[model samples]
Target chain A: MAGGTEIVAHRSGIEKAVAGLILVACAFYCFHALGLNFGSLSNPRSGFMPSVIGVSATVLAAVNLVLTLRKHRMAEADEVALDRYTALNLLMALAGTIAFLVLLDLAGYVVASALYLLFLTKLTRSPGWLVPMAVSIGATGFFYFCFVMLLGVTLP
Target chain B: MENFALLMQGFQASLALHNILAALAGVTLGTLAGVLPGIGISGTIALLLPISFGMEPLTALIMFSGIYYGAMYGGSITSILVNVPGEGASVVTMIEGYQMARRGRAGAALAIAAIGSFVAGTLGVVGITFIAPPLAQVAIAFGPPEYFAIAALGLLVLTNLSGGSALRAVLMMLIGLMLGTVGMDYMTGLVRFGFGVDGLGDGLDFIVIVMGVFGLGEVLARICERQNDVRVTKIKFKDLYPNREETRRSILPIFRGGLIGAIMGLIPGPSGTISTFASYALEKKLSTRREEWGKGAIEGVAGPEAANNAASSFTMIPLLSLGLPFSASAALLLSGFMIHGIQPGPMLVSTEPVLFWGLIASMYIGNLICLILNLPLVGLFASVLRAPMRYLMPVVALVTFTGAYVLNYSLFDLGVLTFFGFLGFFLQMSGYSLAPLALGAFLGPQLEQGLIQTMVLTDGNIWTLMTRPLAGTALWLGVAMIGWMIFRFIRQLLRRSSSQPVAEDV
Candidate 1:
């Protein structure tokens, strides 16, 4: 029960943080949209729709953040603990994808994709290195044949 | 008689050798997508949109239609066998279907679902054949005000019905609309939020955002969970038939559910999922053996499965006739159509009668193909569940990367994909629905165009714009929907506050 409470508290914290981030995004969007041409309603310009949407979103996000804070207060702020395993797994996958992007520029599609798959398969705790290696290489080859050879898609 | 002749012409076109092969490949891939838990119909269609660039528009559309309904058939397999629904529509089936699986009546449940899907799906095609032409005729009269009203109503109804906090759904939708404004303004040709990036000149690609959110985001979410082997229920070939009593019981429910779905599908919301739940409730009420519902009633499996398939077929009417997508999957299908340089709307019937009628005709063939494929191949499809996630997720991630890169060969698009992927993951985690976001992005331009055109036509008098009959009714409906959401929201807050003191005291 205590562990469950802690998890809920941690989730509440994350929710509040997300709400805050969205609110900030909405603000930035509004500011950026305002800088563009705000043509009159009779003949609305490019920025008109964005400005309207940004303002509405900013208001809604603010309300969401307030509601989240109120809910957090109502819950009495139990002990906060993160799900480290899930977090770490998500981080690894994201980092690996970003690394793939960089490597695709530095190396090439073949090497970057193969390494990305290898890293992800291992991260998923495939039985051993051999299986991950085989799966990654085999899958990369299939993708290459399908995309490049058959579909005539050029890959860098 | 003219419609009949046109439909016959459609049959002739769809029966061509290549179209048949296209339909075959589509259903097969669609089934695979439905069986796989990680990716869904939206992701699959989005992935294939780029690949379909080279095919004839008719062939690509035929294939997409096959995938659309084939997925409905395939989703039931996982729900019944492994107790995990492959998609949202199959969730209802998992209840009694999984229970039936536990009782070793899995074969009967599977057989009934396939039969029901085929019957309802065919019925939906017949409905579309007669109804969509007239609907398109009526839609041709719609002007800017009406279009704006319909689009606003769609966004409102979807966010209201998208199964979360209405505020969160609206927020996601607004954000999507903002994203839609990032590229060139069609009316003015001015880039609103380009941030000096050359890639923003054409605007954010819809397929790229969809791939990131649905494909890569789903993979990220799945890999974060602990990998566990799924236990699939085994069935012999001989056990595949439903017995006499079960077969008789399912017939009425199948028809009843099909009618319910055909009607619901016309509404602008998640009709596929909603219709299944509605059918289940209706069947529960109508069943004499109500006690068997939660336990392994064959009717429970038959009705919802039929309803979802029927709903999937009927949902295409709006997309085909009005060029508006009410659901996420339909939106993706609309994107597929646009990618092939085919715009589906009122003029489509007159301008591209062959493609329109051919696609409709292909649905009939596709539904028949799904029925034939699902029955004998259930075992093979069920085997897909046994494939470990460790091997599958990496492959999915790689495909997403490759597909995104191939779209424009732009590395900037890949960056956009990754950004949206992460954004989608976090937003989903925070309890925001992505359907409205996708739908909003898709509809944003249409909505803005309609509003601008109407304003200019009415000389900036928004009231005159609202006074038009069809537009007025649609706008009123949107307002009523908003009022209902607010009422529900306040009631929930009040209930929560009332309950809080009791919890504290306890």
Candidate 2:
């Protein structure tokens, strides 16, 4: 029973955090939209739609936040929120992706992609070094042939 | 008769060697994507959108349509053999299908699903051939006000039906609309929210967001999941044919499911998934072999499978006629058309007759190809499930990154892709539906454009804009939907409160 309570709390906590984030984002968007031109109703300018969207979103977010605080049932999370290990997996994958981007700029597609693939394969717990290495190299080669050789895309 | 003649011309056009090859490749790739649980039709199409850049618009669209139809067939394979639904629409199929598989009728389940998909899909195409032209003809009469009202009604109906809090869907949609505003203001030639970034000048590319959210976002989500060993049921090629009893039973359900799907597909919000559930319930209720339900009933598999495919075909009606996409996959298809400098709507029938009719005609061929491929190649496709996610995810990530780069050859776009990929992952984790966001971003400009045009036409008298007949009806419908949602919410709250006291007393 305590475990069930803990799970519900954790779920609600995530929902509240998401609602808060949305509220902040919408507020910022509304502020930015306000800085743009506000033309007349008949002949609106560039900022008209943004302003309307931003303000409406801000209001909606605020309502959502209130609903969350009141413990009213809102949108139930479709998938389970990340646990500690899964969160770690996500962070590692994200870091690997960012690193791949940096590497691509410094090196080339083949080198960057190969290294990224190797890291990801290992991150997903590929048994040993041999399989990850083979997959990374083979996949990079296939991509090179498909994109550059066949499609004539100049990959950075 | 004229429409038939045009359809004949379309058949001639689609019969080209290149178009046939495109159809073949699309269905094959789509089936493979469907068999793999990690990716879906949206991700596959997003990943391949860049590749389609070099092809002619007709060929590209034909391939996309083929992929759409093929995924339907492929999704059933995983559901039957592994008890894992490959897509949302196949969930019901897994109930009876896996049971059948366990009873050594896996081949029959798969065969029935394929045949049902083919029959329903062809029916849907025939419906499109007859119904869509007339729908487009009517849509051609819509003014800016009516367009605005239609867009508004679509978003409202979708939010209500999208299976979550209406508030959450609306919020996501607003965010998407805000994102759509990032680029240049088309009418004024003034940039609204560029943030002084050079990439912001042209606004965010729809395909980039799609690839990031559907492709990379999916990968990120999958990585966090605990990998389970998938056990595939082996099938003898000889057992692929359904017995006479099974075949006879499936026939009516297939036609009935197809009819349900064809009608529901014309509505908004995940019609394919909805229609399948509806079909499943109806079949169970109407079945003579009621005791077999939830066991190894062939009708259970046949009905929902047909409904989903038929629904998929029907979903194209709104997109092809009104230039509106009611679902995520349809939105991707719309992007495919847009990328080719084509807009699908009333004007398309007149302006791009060959392309319009050709796409419709190609569905016939695509459905045939899917049926043929699914039967003989079931073993080959099912083997894809055995590939470990550890190796597969990396390839997906690399392809995503590579595809993002090829779009504009800009590092900025890659950065945007990464940003949205993470954003999508987090948003999905929070239980936000990404479909509304995708549709919002896609429709934001059109919605804004319509609003502005209506305002201009009505000379700032907004009420006058609503006074227009078609526009008035659509707006009223949206209002009624919102009212209904509020009433339902209040009723639920009251019921919960009442139930709580009874529970405490007990």
Candidate 3:
């Protein structure tokens, strides 16, 4: 129970930090908008709407931050449990997407997409190498036929 | 007489051989897509958008129009056979429809839902045919202030109606609005928020976000959750029809649901889902057999299914007439219009009468096709649940990623997809809905343009917003909606507090 409380506290800290980061981002955007000249409302310049939204967003984020902090004080913060395997799977998904992004322009769509699919399939379940390879190849071939051959979409 | 003639001409165009085949293929594919558990209406449309890229605009539209109503029919299939709703609008259908299925009436539930959807869809198209042109004519008189009021009101209502806390919804909406302000300012020709990236000079593609957030994010979420083995009861053809009394009980509810759905569709803000819920509530209130509501009531299946299909059909009005999309699905249709190099607005009818009328005409044919398609294939579609998520999600992810990459062929868009997917997952995990955010992103620029134009016309005087009749009414309606939400929030808070004492005492 004590360990659970500790984990909750740790999660709360992370949550508050994320809220603070949002506030900071809002401030940064507002600062950028302020740098651009704010024309009159009648003849608004490029920055007018952005600056207004930026300010409004900053206020909302501030309110959200306050609410989060208050909820934390009341000890009612919800803890989102992240199991190790699930976390690993999420990271693997992210890695696969990043790899696809890099390989998309380099290795081309078929190879990159196949690699990403294979990686994701393997990450989700411990499939044999053959199954992952077969699935990836099949998926890539289908995408190519539908998108490239049929739809006339250009791919790298 | 003139409108009838116009519709006849549209049928003449829509009934062409190629168009018929497109409609058939579209509804078939759409029903299959909708029958899949994780693939939603918006996600299905987004994934298939690339396939339509090569087709002529009319053919593409005939296909899309088929998919639109076909999804409504397909959604109720899974809801009845399994407890899982294939789409958001069918969530309420699962409540009572599943119970009906459990009582050995799955076939009856499915049949009633299909019939209701067909009735609602047909009536809704009829409503749209008459109502849209007049609405467009009226919209022609609207100035920038009126347009701004309408668009801003839509964003505000979306934020309010989105399921979550008001603060979080507003925050997400503001974030979406900020995201919209990225890229270059059109009026000033000034680059903003590009952060030195060449691709950011043009605003983010809506399709990329749709693919990422709705498609890949959902896939990731599904992957993280443990899959449960769902049991599907085999439905036979002979058992499809309800008894005579059951049919009698359903007819009134179906008509009521269609009426409710058609009206809600015109109002915006998750209209399809809202209409279903509203119809279900209305049915419960008015049903003589209210005692059987939670226990596999036939009215439960009929009303919401009818309402959602009707709502889906009429939801086109705002997009077609006013050039504003109320939901992500409507936004997809708007994107479809833009892809065809035709803008949807008050001038759409005048500018592209054939395209506009042809789409409306095709919807009627699509409805007929969906009814023909879904009623017999409910059993086959329900068996799709046997496919495990492990095998399914990987394919979904691949399609989503490919769709994103193919849109602009930009690695930067892939980056956007990844970022938004991550963001969408986090927001969804935190119990924040993405509909408001999506609405904000879609409507934000239009709202900005309308506001700026109005400002220029009014010389920056904000009070002139209230001086215009239509703009004033819209702004007041928006304010009233916000006020009502605040009141409801406070009342709920008070009730919670009052109940807390009783709980502590217990």
Candidate 4:
């Protein structure tokens, strides 16, 4: 049972592999986008340093993949455990957060955030209309006190 | 003698009504943030940094510093009650602390943590007072080359710090270092990875990268995970303060932690974090009653709590003395010094004696204030977990993004926050420690500036990194540490090999 857990983890290695690849690829994008030449002092190209990082990220991914595969092999003996609901909650939270950030400028911080909170709380297992309303109104009011009144921070 | 007088002046100023109020406000906000899940004090501080623009530098810094230390004190509140750690620094505390709470000993754990924090924090501040000035004296003699060596030594923590895979840690560190090099070449005034965006001209603001990777990224991931609903148990008032028997059990740990924290703080790397972890391991390793450790043994809570506070104080040693930041918060403090146009290195003792010694003296006062406040408010802070995440997260978001906009009134940094937040989330998912990545980004530009200047001065002698005696000695020490790590790893491997066959046979 314990061993099977690691096998479960190995399944998630694809994510790491993908992420590392993206990081590395982004490095190439960053590399091509820069101008590195200067006068006679002759500095290293901007992309040169970044490419090194990109390659390093790629290497890290390869290693991660290897570890993941190895863990998968051991999964039969030692299975990893994951909490599904916890993971699901995290996903909803992320989506809600992204929507909040994207639309905050248009809707304004207080209004946009209220919608984000209202939506997330309602979607979660604790979905009470009161919970979302209280959370949204409370969040806006607190921000108003600290950022608006006390700190005099002008909201976007 | 002059330093002593200046410390006195600083003490007086730190205690002034406005500064004290700021410290109180910082602690209140810090505790609220610490008690809440998914929100961190760093993001909060980043949010408020711009508000200080209109205020006097002293008042502003005093408030931020309070926010900083207050968060540390408050972070334990969350970890002890709920199984979730509100901040990374308090992760270890949550382990034993929640276990203690489960065993119906929440009061005991809280008492030990608060008391130990007070004791170690006081001693740690004393260590800062004595250790910092002399270190500053030595730093005064340092050139850019020496600075580079020190910075390198700090960055190398990525390897030893990687709990699982050293190679991966090194890989992450190198990647982070390269990321640091992105943006404008300060010396040449030329853009490196700016991509012709006018915004890229200044290079990526470390704040943006840091907030994104740690703050926004973490939020995104947290939002997705189905979390346990917040539950904070009540604490009886009588049980809030540790009695003599409990205090006696905790004494040795607090003392040990104080000493360890002081020494670690003086080192160039992320000493505070390492010290806290090491203190916990040491407590567990040395305890005759080992089983009690995971069960929320008072010593377990006491030792690491003390270590954490002590480390916080000692961090100032490097920041105030060498102007070399060894942690993320310390780097930000260094930035604060630069913002105030007070270079925090050797010259601090000479040029800004009042401000410098005042801060040092204020550390002592601050510790006292923490003690006075923490014991009475344990339950209050613990109860903060009752608030819903839906309510908590938005306030945090508004503060952070609003804080970003106020910097240059640019929405771009907010984008940086989202991007880095996702990145931080991914890194967290993959078991990559964002500590090194973040500190690297923060220190990268400074390290670059130092290295470029040092190289030019030496006429392209890469060997200069080695030849300089003081720096050379530090380099050798690093080599020795590596050698020792290899030895330990081999020994561990052999032990595991021998045990493997036995385990298989069993």
Question: Against the true chain A, what TM-score does chain A of candidate 4 give?
Answer: 0.65
Candidates 2 and 3: which is better by DockQ?
A: 3
Q: Give candidate 1's root-mean-square deviation (CA, Å).
A: 3.0
Model 1 docking category: acceptable
- Model 3 ranges off by over 4 Å: A1-21, A72-81, B482-506
Clashing pairs in 2: B183-B203
TM-score of every model versus the real structure: 0.96, 0.95, 0.93, 0.86
Tens digits of per-residue lDDT for model 3, B1-506: 88788888889899999998999888877777777776678877876676677788888899998887766677787788878787789999999999999999999999999899999999999998999999999999988899999988888887777665777777777777877888888898888888899988998888787777777787887775555666888999889988998899899989999999998988767888999899999989987776798999899989999999889888898888999998888898788768777789999888888888998999999999888877787787777767766667888788777777777778888899888887777656555667777777778888889888888999999888887789999999988988997797568557755653221100
Cα distance off (Å), candidate 2, residue B149: 1.3
What overall lDDT goes with each candidate model? 0.85, 0.85, 0.81, 0.67
Residue B506 in model 4: shift from native, Å?
28
Q: Which 10 consecutive residues of model 4 chain B have the lowest summed lDDT? A: B497-506
Q: Per-residue lDDT tens digits of candidate 1, residues B1-506?
A: 98889999999999999999988888887887778785667877776666665689999988988788677767888899988887778899999999999999999999999999999999999998999999999999999899899889989988877776788899988988887887888887887778899998889988899898887788888776668998999988899999999999999999999999998888877888899999999999998998788998988999998998888889889888899999888999998888789999988998999989998999999998888877998898888888898788778778888888887899889989998888878776766789888988889889999988988888788888667899998988888888998898788778877785321110
Report the error of model 1 at residue B449, Å.
0.9
Better of 2 and 4 by TM-score: 2
Candidates, ranked, DockQ? 1, 3, 2, 4
Q: What residue pairs are clashing in model 3?
A: none
The 10 consecutive residues of candidate 2 chain A with the worst lDDT sum are A1-10
